[model samples]
Structures are given as structure tokens and as C-alpha cells.
Target chain A: MNSAISVRHLTKDFRIGIRGLKLRAVDDLSLEIPRGQVYGLLGPNGCGKSTTLKVVLGLVSATAGEISILGEPSATSAARRRTGFLPEAPYFHKFLTGRELVRYCAQLSGVAASDLDAAVEDALGLAAMKEAAGRPIGTYSKGMLQRIGFAQAVVHDPELIILDEPTAGVDPVGSASIGRMIHAMRDKGKTVVLCSHLLGQVEQVCDRVAIMDRGKLVLEGAVEDVLSRRDRHVMTIEAMTPAARTAAEAALEAHGAKITSVTHPRRSLEDLFRELVTGSRDA
Target chain B: MKDSLRRTLWISRVTFLEAVRQRFFAFLLVLSAAMVLSSVSLRVFDFGHGELKFIADFGFGGMFFFGSVLAVVMTAQLFFSEIDNKTALTLLAKPLSRPEFLLGKFFGAWAVLGVFVLVLASLQGVVLWAREQELIAAAEQAGRIPTTFSIVGLCQLVLLQWLRLGVVIAIVLAISSLARTFLFTVVVGSLAVVAGQLQWIAQDAFLRPTDSPAYAAFLWISTRLIPNLQQFNLADALVLGSSAVEEGALIAVCLSGLAYLVAYLTLGSLIFRQREI
Candidate 1:
């Protein structure tokens, strides 16, 4: 279908304590994630973002609603066959090497025996884990673990990939690497639904964004449409003195324009960090 | 169907590998092996029984006790490690079903117990054979009938023990499906094993006419629901030839074990299908 994932007014509630108190985790959320785009689901902890994803993936049952993946019911294996998932803070068997883990996932995902090796190699190569694939998972750093987790998720070449907090504990370089991977998946005509607290990375990578707050969808739209103000404007000028700034403000006001504020452009700290550590990695 | 089976096989393969690498399995295997070896030295305390019989009983005791511990503790640990680590989230989000996942776990734990039984049974056989030869020579000198053990019976007992442990693993898995924590599963699984051992009491009480209907109903359900684990203790009859076990009776015991195993696995799968992850 045109929509890779469709959630229709989904709600999820959890019971807590011996008293059976109801805790609503997701409240009547509806979404239509378009195919072949990078979509971001963002929220603070306990805002029901993860719960929504879990319900969509059929890891948890919805309290009330309907969800479908690739035109099939969300809970069915037929739907999951076309979807891949990378859980937050992923943990793997420490005894298995990165290669073995990927291969095992491929087997579970039903990769044909003839294509298993090639599929595994391609996924590892995409995650930049081929070099360290032979090392046991226990020896992997947090960044390496995320990368290998990415490798396993995409090993079967699923049409839709859902990644939850893919860069939670990684350095800026690793985070950037994951951002690039999201971009590559989008380039390959695959639908990617990403959930992360890293708003900067989400803005950089997502074509569409949905924000959840307190178990409710507060905002959902294209990144540019939701984030940009049509009335606002910005310009960068080189080598301007105090007199030049006064003249520029006068010139703008004469044309029915007013500059709200003036300030020097500054590089984001993440950009500076990546620039400083471009050649070094925890891998 | 083939694809599902393939997925189950892969899961079980990983589960088996994870279990074998654990220090707990290694420690128990070594301890059981030591108990079997030390039985020869402790034969003087056999309390007037034949030396071969004492060795057999000691080794069988180690197998029964340690095998149950492994079946209960190790099975729960393996299942929980996946849940607590969130590996289940990664695996379950694929095209795999809940029943396939649980069955994979059952086979994996059962395989490890298979190794445990095989190793101990082989060692017991070696010890029995060596002692049998010694007794034969002593009997020739004193003109007495020598006590001997049956090799075929040892093999049969080994199979029965494996099946018994398989039943325990299934029961633990069924408990783990509903348990919120590993500790709960292990505690309840241990209690189930104990009940299975004493299940014959329920069976005996049910066979005799009882006046109380509630008591009879309870006994009736208990006898059917809990396996007669005591029935699998055929080592004395099978290995030492102390009594002749009819082939039909052995078959009946095996069928009973298989029935319990299937019933528990089916129950576990049903409960797990509704579990939240």
C-alpha cells in the first residue's frame, strides 16, 4: 500500500500494582506513515511513544484500535515478514560474534540458504560492522553494539525498518553514522520509522515528524511544515560593523520588513564534536 | 510449516549454545560426575547391599537430584535471560510466533539435560562393569553366585531419565510463561517437581474408595495433572535386574511422560501467546 504503516485511533493501557489501577500509555493516536520516507516518532520518557511502537509491532496488544502493516493486520506474521525492528538499548547474547548474530537473525527472518551469506554480508557492510563482525558481542562498545543491532535488523532486507533509540548511548560520530544509515534506507525506497530523543538528529534525517506528549499526539506534519515559520526570515552577511547594521535595519523597515533580532551564527556543538573526532571511533 | 520449523530450529540452536556456555551447567555436570566416581569409595556404607547395587544407586541418586536441579533452574534462567535482556523484543518482532519460540526453548533445555543424563549413565555403566568383574572373580574363589548388571537395561534407563527431565523442562516452561520473575518460575517449578515425585500418593488415594467427594475430586485431578515422576525410577529394575519390568509397562510409562510433556508445552504456548512480551 501507499502507507507503509497505518494506525487508526490506537490506545494502550497497562495495569499496575495488585489493585489493578489502569495506566493509559497511548491515547487514541492515529498515524499514516507514507512509504519510502524517514518518519520520526519523538517524545519524552513515559509519553507512550515506545508503547505505540510496540503496539504497532505487535509486541504488545492495543487496548483499543486497529493497526495494519503493508495491508496486513499488524499482529499477523504476514505483516511482520515485511517489517524489521531494532529495539532500544539492544542486548544480544555475549557469546555470539557479531557475524553469527546477524546470520542467526537472517535465518530467523527466513532468508533462503542460497542468499543467506550474501544478505548477511550486505547488512554488516551497511552498518560498517564487517571489520569487527568476528569479535564476540561482549567485547563491543556501546556504539558497536548499536551498529551490529542495526545490521541484524536489516539483514533480511525488510521493506519497513523500525528503529527505537538507535543512538541512545553513542558518540556524535556514531549517531551521525546511524543518521546516515537512515538516509541510505530512505534512498533505497524503504520506509523507516525512527523513535529517538535526539531531536537534532531527527530533524536532520526525518522527512516527516510526529511528536507525542503525555500519551497524546501533540503535533504531526512534514519536518519543514511543522518546524518552519513562514513569516520568519534569516540572512547571513559577512563583515558588518555597527553603522552597517543600523543601515540594514533602516533599509528593511522601509520595505515593510522588520528584523526581529540580530546575532552571529554559531555551529552546533554536535557539529563541532564530529569535526574534532572525525577519524576516531569506539569501533 | 517448513519455514516455522526452520525458525524453531535456529532458536533452539542458539538456546542450546547459550546454555552450554553457562558456568552453572558446567559446575553441575562436574559435581554429578564426581558423585558418581566417589560412589565406589562409599560402597562400604552400602548397608549390606551388593557393591554394584550400591554404586548404581548412588550414581542414580546423583542423576535424579542434579538433573532435576538443572531442569528447573537452568530452564528458568535461559527463558528469563531473553526477557530481561530484551532479546525477546528483537526476535519476537519478526515473523516468528509465540508458540514457536516456546517450543524452541523447550527443546534446547531438554538437549542439555540429555547430555547430563548420557554422561552420568555412561560413567555408572563403567563403574558397574568393573565391580561386576571383581565380584565374579571373588565368587569363583569362594564358590558363590556372582551379582551382575545388565548393559541393555542401563541403556533403557538412560532413555527413561531423559524423558523424565524433558517433562520437568516442559513444566518449568509452563510456569515461566505465567511467572513475572525468574525466581517465581524456579520456586514454583521446584515445587512442581516435588509434587510430581509424590504424585503416586495421589494416584494411590484415588485408586482406593474415599468417602469425601471433594477429596476424591482433588485426588483425581492431581493424579492426572501431575506426572508420576517416581515411575521413571526404573534403575533398580532395569539396570540391576532386581525385578523384571514388562515391556508393556515400560511403554506405558514413556507414553505417560510424553503426554505430560505435550500438555505442559501446549499450556505454556497458550499463556505465552497472550503475554505482553
Candidate 2:
């Protein structure tokens, strides 16, 4: 199958002020995001990662180069019909209930009338927003807002989903819920592109990642390939006495190997928090 | 086509809901309604005009002034709110086209104006009818013909005013598409409304023979570009039967309103298509 998204030599320059000075937002960036995997696009603020996504999704026009989604021109409605997007810090009509907003979006996304009910319910179920779907969005907490935004994006059952800062300003528990939703999208064979600053969550969930800096791609590879150090190794030895440790090191030295350092394995703070607050939910 | 229409309607539905819920709409509606209701008490200063005509003038003035304000300010507010709040980001990312979004907003704001016209016209009609009955009784007792107003004419006026507001909304949308801020759109849109109201000056100058080709060319462009809003302000003639307006003329005005409405909306959408969301 074709890549879920193909961006070739995409550059974007925004004109600033009446003098028309050009400010380059993204410069000659190319990417091929594959299908059926969770991919993370990571960068600090103003690094053009968001601009690149916006260009791919056709929200902003590219200054030069080409882009396609599933073999179709990225800006065409046909391409957009098969894709979904949740913008960063999403804001919705405050008067609409969560269900109403989702249904409205589903219709706009071209969901067939016969399947709309099932599609809406399935989306709400996936986002864990079913209980609060009937309440007005003004009453929702930050987590509930993000979850409902996720539900709306997925309501039409698009093949590819792009979420920009889906967990920004959300607490850890809420962030974990979003992580689960991303996993669920991947499980259903949907391509997921996540843009976020939370590196720990990106490392945990992304199958592949591409890091951008100064409007250029600095690194792109499989998560394991990029994160693992090949020249160095660590082995965990449990319940070894001091004499045994000394014998093991001497034996390794004879084989031209040496133990560099020894320390107890530690769990990450996120893992510890999740473990201690097992039942806490943002809802 | 049907699917696109449905999508536009869905957008308009939500926009209408959002706009109607605003305290701004209610506040203006109440203020306009008060003006229309208070016209009955102000009939003493008729200035030599008929009593019903005086009342009708007061009521129409209220509708016109308040309706224009609503059209200019409210439409810009609605469009910019979506952009500033990033709600347009979500909606525009869908399969919905830029033209569809603009049309949806047009219809939504137009619908709110429809309600505004209806409520105020109904109140004005009631006040006129009540005063007419009293006048008719006294005139019959004095053996003179009682001056009256036409219900059908009032209805036509309502439709015309609604169309005028629709034109204003479309104009504002076009401005908002190119504008960077709400204040800019409103300022330019209000100026456009004023220009449209005075567009007949160019039309008159164009009618007179002129040797200056540059002046004629400027007038030609002005006449063609700025819609003549004065054509729709026949409330006194239409409502009070002060003069006879030909059917062909009314049709021409309606057609002109629709042409400008479609033209401005299309221009707005084209500009908006290039906007970086």
C-alpha cells in the first residue's frame, strides 16, 4: 500500500507585514509516514513540526513542493474525506453537547446517515466519553474536552488520524487515556500521527519517530533503532553475592570483557505514578 | 451536491444556535423592539405627515439602524470567533469546502436577521393596526376617509429588509476574509455599508455626460462594484402606499440584491481558501 502520507520537498514561507517580508516556517522538509503505525513528530515550539502537519493536512498552503495522502493530492476533498484531524488545544461550540458536536462533525465528514448512530457511539466508547456525551461542552474539564475532541476526529472512521498536542495541558492520567486511544487506533489498523512535546509518552507509544529542528528533519527512524545504543550493553544480575560478583568479573576479564557499572534498575516517575494511582481517571 | 448542501446546513445550524444564544442578540432585539413599541407614543410630532406614516417611519428607522448594526458587527464577530477560537481549524480540516463554510455562515446570520425583522415588524404592525382602528372610528364619525396601511406591503418590506441585511452580511464576510482582526473587518464593513448607501451619487454622475474619461471610468467601476442599497429603502412607499412601485422595478432590485450577495460570498470564499488556518 502507498504510504499513509507523502510529503516531498515541502517548504512554507509566510509573508509578514505590509512590506511582504518572507518568514520561512518549514524549509524543504520531506517525509513518508507509513500506514498502520503510531508515528510521532517531535520538536520544540516554532520548530515547524506543526507547520509541516498543517501543510500535509492542507490547512496551510505550501510555498513549494508536493504532498499526497493515500495517493491523492493532499488538499483535495477526496483525500480529506479519508483523513481526520484534531487540532491543538481544540475549542468547540460551547452550546453543543459532546454528542451533538460529534454528530455534527460526523455529518460534515460525510458519514452515511444509516451508520451515524453506530459510528458516533463507537467513537464515544473508544474515547471513554459516552457518559458525558450529553452534557454541554462548557461544563467539561480539560481532559473531557480532549477526549471529546478525539471522539469527534474519529467519528467518521477515517483511515488516518492526525492529533496535534492531544495531551497538552492535560494531567498525566488524562494523558494516559489519550495514549490508550492512540493504541486503539493503531490496533484497528489505522495510521496515527501524533505531534507532541511530551517525549516520554512519545517514546512509549510511537512505533517510529521523526525529530525536526530549525525547519529541517534531524532524525527519522524506528524507535528502537534511534533509541538503542549498539556499542554499549547492560545486564541485570539478580541475587548475586559479593564473591560471585567478583568471580563473574574476573571470568569476564579473561574473555576480554569487563563490567563497567552496576546499579539497581529504577522505574520511571510516570510508571510509579500510574502504579500508585491505579484507579484515578480524568473523567 | 446534496451532501454538500447538507454539510452547509449543518454548519449553519450550529452557527444559528451559537448566535441566538448570545446576550448580544437578545440585547439588541430588546432595544429594537422597544424602539418599535415606543413609536406609538411619539406620533404627536408627525411634522405634517399622516399619523400612521409617522409611526411607520419611526419603526422602519429603528429596524434599519439596528439591523444594519447587527449585520455589520454580528457577522464579523461570528466569523472571527471561529478563526480566533480555532474552531474553524477543526471544521475546515473536514471534507467541507471553504465556500461551503462561508455560505453556511451567510445563511446562519441571515436567519438570525430574519428573526430580528419578524419580531420587530410584528410589533410595528400591531401598533399601526391599533392606531388605525381608533383613527378609522373617529374619521367615520367625522365622515372622512380613514388613512390606513397595507399588511401585504408590510410583509414585502420585511422580505426586502431581510434581503438587505443578507447583502450586508455577505459584504462583511468578504471583508472578514481579508481582515486580520475583528475591529478591522467591522470598520471596513461599516464604511462599505456607508459607501453602498451613497452609491447612487456615482450612478447620477455616470448618467450625466462627461468629457473626462478617467472620471467616467472611476464612476463606472464604482457603480458596478458598490451595490445601491437605496433601492431597498422603499419602506414608506411600499408600506404606507405613498407611491406606486412597478413590479418590474421590484424584481430588478431583488435580482440585484441576490447578484451582489452571491458575488461577495464567492469572493470571500476565494480569499478564505488562501488564508492560513
Candidate 3:
């Protein structure tokens, strides 16, 4: 299959003032987001990461370049029909119940009438929002809001899903829930592109990542390839007595090797929090 | 085509629901209703005009003023709220087109104005009906014919006013598409309404022969560009039957209103298509 999204020589310039001064938002960027994997696009603030995503989604016009989604030219309704987007800091109508909002999006996304109910319910179920789906969105907490936003984005069953900072301002528990959602999308053969500031979460969930700086790509590779140190290694030894440790060190020294450091493997705080607070949901 | 229309309808459905729930809509509805109801008490200062005529004039004036304000301010507020709140980010990122979004907003705000006009017109009808009965009784005792208002004409006036306000909403939406702030849209929209209300002056100037081609060209553009809002102000002819208006004239007014409505909405859609949401 073709890549989920393709961009070539994409550049976007925004005119700043009456004098027509130009500000370059995206400069000669090219990317090929592969299919059926979770891809993270990471950068600091104003690095043009969000602008690149918006250009791919056709929300903002590119001054020069070509973008295609799923083999179709981008910025067309036909191209967008098979794609879903969850924006950064999502805001929904306060008056609408979660279910209503999802249903509204499904219809707008061209969900067939016969399958609309099933699609909406399935989306809500996946986001774990089915229980609070009938309440007004104003009543939802920050985490619930993000979950509902996720539900709306996927309700149409788009083949490509792009989430921009889906977990911003969300607690770790909510963040974990979103990570699971991303995994679910990947399992279903959907292309998931995540733009996020949380490097740890992105490191955990993304199969591959691209880091940008100053409107240019600095690094792009598989997570393991980019992060692994080939010259060094780590080994975990359990239940080692003092005599056994001395013997291992002597064995290594005889083979012309030495241990630089020794320490126990420590679990991350996120893992510890999840373990201690098992079954505690944002609800 | 069918699916696009469906999307537009879904968007307008939410927009209309959001707009009607606003306290501003309810507040204006109450104020306009109060004006209609209070017209009965205020008839003493009619300055020697006919009783029913004064009442009709009072009600029509209330509808015109409040309906225009509601159209200009409410439409801008609805459009700007979606943009400033970043709700447009979510909605526009979907498969929905920019034109569809702008058209949805137009229809939604127009529907709210429809309710405003309907409620006030109904009140005006009731007040006129009550006074007509009393005047008929007194006139019968005095052996003189009683002057009464036409309910059918009042209904016609309601329809015309709704169309007029629809045009105003479309114009405001066009402005809001290019505007960055709510206050800007309102100020420009209010100014447009004032220009449209006085457009008849340019129309008259265009009719007279002019020596200067520059001035004639100015008048020509002015008359054609700004809709003749005065054409729809047929309260006397339509409601009170002060004079007989030709059928062709009424149809011409309706057609003019619809044309401007379509033209302005098209302009808004084109401008909004280029706008970066």
C-alpha cells in the first residue's frame, strides 16, 4: 500500500502585517508517514511541527509544494474523507452531550445512516466514554474531554488518524489511556500520527519518530535504532551474593573486560503510579 | 451533492442549537415583545394619526430596529465564537468544506432571526386584534365605519421582514469571514445596514441625468452594490393598506432580497475558502 501521507517540497509563508512582510512557517519540508504504525512528530515550541501537520491535513494552504493523502491529492474533500484529525487543545460545543457530538461528527464525516449508530457506539466504547456519553460536555473533566475528542475523530472509521498533542494538559492516567487508544488504532491497521510534547509517552508508544528543529528535520528513524547505544550494553542479574559478584568481576577481568557501573533496574514513575492506582480511571 | 448537503445541515443543526441557547437571544426576544405589547399604551402620543395605523407603525418599527440589531450583532457573534474558541479547528479538520461551514452559519443565524420576527409579529397581531374589536363597537354605536388592520397583510410583512433580515445576516457573515474580531464585524455590519437602508438615495440620484460621468458611475455602483432595504419597508401598504401596491412590486422586492442573500453568501464562501482557520 502507498504511504498513509506524502509531502514534497512543502512550504508555507504567512503574511504578518499590512506591509506584507512574510513569515515562513514551514520550509521545504518532505515526509513520508508509513502505514499501519504509530509515528510521532516531536519538536520544541514553534518548530513548525504543528504547521506540517496542518499542511498535510489541508487546514492551511502551502505556498509551494505538493501533498497527497492515501494516493489522492490533499486539500480535497475526497482525500480528507478517509482521514481523521484530533486537534491540539480540542474544544467542543458545551451544549452537546458527548454522544450527540460524536454522532454529529460521524454524520459530517459521511457515515452511512444505517451504520451510524453502530459506529458512534463503537467509537464511544473504544474511548471508554460510553458511560458518560449522555452528559453535557461541560460536565466532563479534562481527561474526559480528551477521550471524547478522540471518540469523535475515530467515529467515522478513517483509515488515517492524526492526533496533535492529544494528551496536553492531561494527567498521566489520561495520557496512558490515549496511548492505549493509539495502540488500538495501530492494531486495526490504521495509520496513527501523533504530534506531542511529552517525549516519554511518545517514546513509549511510537514505533518510529521524527524530530524537527528550526523548520527542518534533525532526526528520523525507528525508535530502537535512534535510541540504542551500540557500543554499550546492560545486563540485569538477580539474587547475586557478594561471592558471586566477585567471581563475575574476576571472570570479566580475565577476559580483558571490566564493569563500569552496577545498579538495579528501576521502573519509571509512570509505571509505579499505574501499579499503585490500578483500576482507578479518570471517571 | 446529497452528502455535502447533509454535512451542512448537521453543522447548521448544532449552530442553531448553540445560538438559540444564548442569553442574548432570549433577552432580545423579551425586549422586542415588550416593545410590541407596550405599543398599546404608547398610542396616546400618535400625534393625531389613526389608532390602528399608529399601533401598526409602532410594532413594525420595533421589528425593524431589533431585527436589524439581532441580525448584525448575533450573526457576527456566532461566527467569531466558533473561530476564537478553536472549535473551528475540530470541525474544519473534518471532511466538511469551508463553504459548507460558512453556509451552515448563515442559515443558523437566519433561523434565529426568523423566530424573533415570528414571535413579535404574533404579539403585534394580538394587540391589533384586541383594539380593532373595541374600535368596531364604538364606531357601530356612532354610525361610522371602523378602521381595522389586515392579518394577511401582517403575515406578508412578517415574511418580507424575515427575508430582509436574512440578507442582513448574510452580509454580516460575509464581513465576519474577513474580520478578525467580533467588534470589527459588528461595526462594519452596522455600517453596511445603514448604507443599505439609505441605498434608495443613490437609486434616485442614478435616475436623474448627471453632467459628471464620475459622479454618475459612483451612484451607479452604490445603488447596485448596496441592496435597497427601503423596498422591503412596506408596512403602510402591506399592513395598514394605506395604498395599493402592485403585485409585481412585491415580487420584485422578494427577488431582490433573495438575490442579495445569495450574492453575499457566495462572496462569504469564497472569502472563507481562503481564510486560514
Candidate 4:
């Protein structure tokens, strides 16, 4: 019933060189990701998104503040057991097949022997990696690697999954696939925290977004709440003659409202691309 | 406790698999095997020393050198590969503790070195046995007593060598936990091995009287800090029975090796827990 993750007043500083100069990586960061929603953490490189995730996962020690995962202390094994993480540019052992890698992670995540097979299979299927699961990881393309990474992270069925740069270096088709996977996670009542620099993809897949810059949160809101223009309005008309258009403009003018420039509704280029090239997977 | 151990074992299993697949392990195994096998033909040039002593020295030297190299270089490589390749990022994010990860790496590398020493020791044993039979026949023909070797002593030596190398692996793991690069770990680890091999000199100086208390204290700390790797070089006494080595002394050496091994691994786990993966 608690928030999926609760972070407050968090700060992280990294020491540099022999002189021990302190570099602040995450500054007064606070986030409250709701349960069972797809939340996007958007930031440029070196903007502290990855560092915050690492601190949340207990991979790095924080310099100050507090964080919790699923109502438990962030760094505890119990917290980690309920959370899953897929790192940026995920690199697995080249020698292991995709299936082997997922199974290995499942065991490490404490998946029971009785449920291990079904868990692995279900995860692989969700990531669309089941067909390529038998191949060595070294032979995988970049998209397949990310897909396999997804499978491994979700194999244990953790309540919360943190993904850093999950769609980096992936083609748009593959990126869309990951977007759908994120949607699927949300549909399953799993809290999904995603960090990516792709704004268009974030706009499509994320329910809420927080943008970061220079170790600081620049903005946070629901996608529609943040993007919608309340002051402007548009109405699409069809089969209107010049007389009808003039009459409509006069009616608006009589009400002390001016008619702005209007254009035909157009689909986004991404939509066009997806429509034309429907089944071309970046496998 | 059982679950924790199982997690540690799982990590160790993967570590061992990764280590064995490396070309460096295969290369060293072949090179060490060749040295053991070549000890026979090279025995002709023993320079008036007893044949078995020369063979034992050659084979033991190969084990010592290559085993140390494997421990220092291979352990450091295994640790750094995980860190540099970002595989540690994926792994440490799991429910596994940092100590479990470090111990898993130690055991895995130690297991690889175990196989390396076992192979070289068995080959050396075969070479020693075949030469001993030939010498027995020749001595029977000439009515001259032949110098005999002990297989039991050889087995004991193998165990000692494995313990020594395990200590070396632990030292390298401790260094790797703090090091930022593979080269740094290897250079420092190799230097540590060399210093350990010469640690006996500091122990000797500590025993003698010194005018400066400061110097004496330095020697005392130095003697205790670095392990006396030279203490385990009992090839002559163990294999050829050139001198007596008491069972108590052997047990003492094993215990000393174990103490250092545990100390270094514990220290490594502590340092690794603070490391940002």
C-alpha cells in the first residue's frame, strides 16, 4: 500500500583524484514514484539520473539523505529482493546463452527451483527474447541484448523495476518494443522507473515524467499536465465552404475572440514510420 | 546461513567458469605441464646432483613460478574484468552482498589454481616414479643403493603449494578491491608476492639485536605484515628426504598460510563493501 519508492533530501558526492576533491553528483534529490505507474526519469548525460538510481539500488553510498524501496530501507537485501535493476548499457558474460544468463540471474534473485522455469520462460516471452534465448550473448545484436537484459531483470518478478537507458543505441522499432514492455509492466501492476534521454519515446510510454539537469530536478508532472496549453484551443472543421468559414470567424469575433491560424491535422513522422514499416524488428 | 552460503557458491561457480574459459589459464597449464614433462630429459644435466632432487627442484620451481603468476595476474584480471566490463553493475544489484561477491571470486580463483597445481604435481609425480624405477633397476645391476623419493611427501608438498597460492590469490583480491585498474593490481600484487618471498630476511633481522628501537620496530612490523613465502619451499626435505621436517612444523606452515588467507579475504570484503560498483 506504500509508495513503490520514496526518496527524500538525497545527496551524493564523489571524491576525485588523490587530492580528494568532492564532486556532488546528486543534490537534494527527492522523488515519490507511485505504485503501478510508468514513471520516466529524463536527463542528459552526467545529470545525476544514473547516480540516483545507483543510490536507490544501494550500489553506491550516498553522501546524505534517505531513500526507501517498497517501504523498506533502500539498501537492505530485503529491499533489493523486491526491486529489480537493469543498468545502462547492460553487458553480460559473452559466454552464456541468453537462457543461461536469465536463469543465472533468477537463481541469484532467489527464485525458487519450482518456479524458476516458468519465471524464466515468462520473462523471456515478455521481452520478446524467447526465440533468441538459446544463442550466445556475444552473438546478439544491441536490441537483443537490451531485450535479454530486460528478461533477466524481470525474471524474479520484483514489484519494482528500475531501467537505466533501456532503449539506448536501439532502433526506433526496438525502442517501441521496449515501450510496449514498459506498458505491459504497468498493466501488470508493477511500478516501472525508467531513465532515458529519448523525449519522444518518453512522451509516448511514460505516464509521469521528472526531468533533471545538473544534479537537480528541473521539472516533474504528468505528461499531459506538463505539455497541454490551457490558453490555446483548436477546432478541426471538415466540408466547410468559404461562406461558412467567414460566418464562423464572425461569430468568434462577435464574442471578442480572434481566430488564430489553422491547419489540417497531421500525423507525426514517428507514427508514419511505424505505420509504413510495421514488422521490421531490429533483431 | 545456508542460503547465504548457497548464494556464495553460485557466484563462485560462475567465477570459476569464467576463469577456466580464459586463454591465460589454458596457456599457463600447457606451459607448466611442458616444464614438468621436460624435467626428465633435463635431468641428464643435473650437474652431479642427485637425479630425483634435480627433478623435484625443476618441477617445484615451475609450480611455484607459474602458480604465483596465475594467482597474481589471473585473480586480478578476473576481478577487474567484472568491474571494467560493468558486469559487476548487473551482479551487485542483486540480493548478493559485497562480501559474498568477493569471497566468491577468491574461492573461484583458488579453485582454478587448485587444478593448475594438481596437474603439475601429478605429472611431476609420474616423471619421478618412472625415473625412480629406472634408477632402481640400474642400482640393482650395479649393486649401488639408489636415493629414494616419497610419494607421500610429494602429496604433502602439493597441498602446501596449493595453500601458498591460495594466500597469493587472497592478497591479489584484497588489492583488486581497492585498485582502479588491472595494471595497478598486478604490479602491486606481484610486488607483494616478491616481498612475501623475502619476508624471512626481516624476521631474521628482528631476531638480532639492534641499536635503534625504531629500526627494530620496523623490522617487527615488516616481519608480521608480509607472509614468509620461503617457509613453504621444502622440496628437498619433503621429496628427497634430504632433511627431516616435523609434522608440527608442516601444520604450523599450513596454519600460517590459512591465517593470512583469511585475514586478507576479510580485509578485502570490508573494503569491497564500501566500493561503488
* Cα RMSD to the true fold for all candidates: 0.8, 1.1, 1.3, 1.5
Evaluated on chain B only, what are the TM-scores of all the candidate structures, in order? 0.99, 0.98, 0.98, 0.98
lDDT of 3 by residue, B1-277 (tens): 8988888888888889998999988988898889889999999989899989898888889899999998998899899989998899888888899999998998888888888999999999999999999999999999999998888899999999999999999999999989999999999999999999999999999999999999999999999889989899998998889999898989999999999999999999999988887
CAPRI quality level assigned to candidate 2 from its DockQ score:
high
Q: Backbone clashes in each candidate structure, one number apiece?
A: 0, 0, 0, 0
Model 2 error, position B168 (Å):
0.4
Per residue, candidate 2 scores C-alpha lDDT tens digits across B42-79 of 88899999999999999999999899999999999999
Looking at candidate 3 chain B, the ten consecutive residues that score lowest on lDDT are B4-13
Provide the lowest-lDDT 10-residue window in model 4 chain A. A274-283
Q: What is the lDDT of candidate 2?
A: 0.93
- The candidate scoring highest on TM-score is 1
Residues A1-283 of candidate 2: C-alpha lDDT, one tens digit per residue: 4699998999999999999999998889999999999999999999998898888888999999999998899999999998989999999999999999999999999999999999999999999999999999999999999999999999999999999999999988899999999999999999999999899999989999999988989999999999999978988889999999999999999999889998899998888888787776886
Error of 4 at A271 (Å): 2.5
Interface residue Cα RMSD of candidate 4 after superposition: 0.7
| Candidate number with the higher DockQ (2 or 3) | 2
Q: DockQ: which candidate is best? A: 1
lDDT by residue for model 1 (A243-279), tens? 9999998999999999998899999999899888967
Q: Which residues of candidate 4, in runs, are more than 4 Å off?
A: A238-244
lDDT of 3: 0.92
Query: Can you write out model 3's per-residue Cα lDDT over A94-205, one digit (the tens) per residue?
Result: 9999999999999999999999999999999999999999999999998899999999999999999999999999978889999999999999999999999799999999
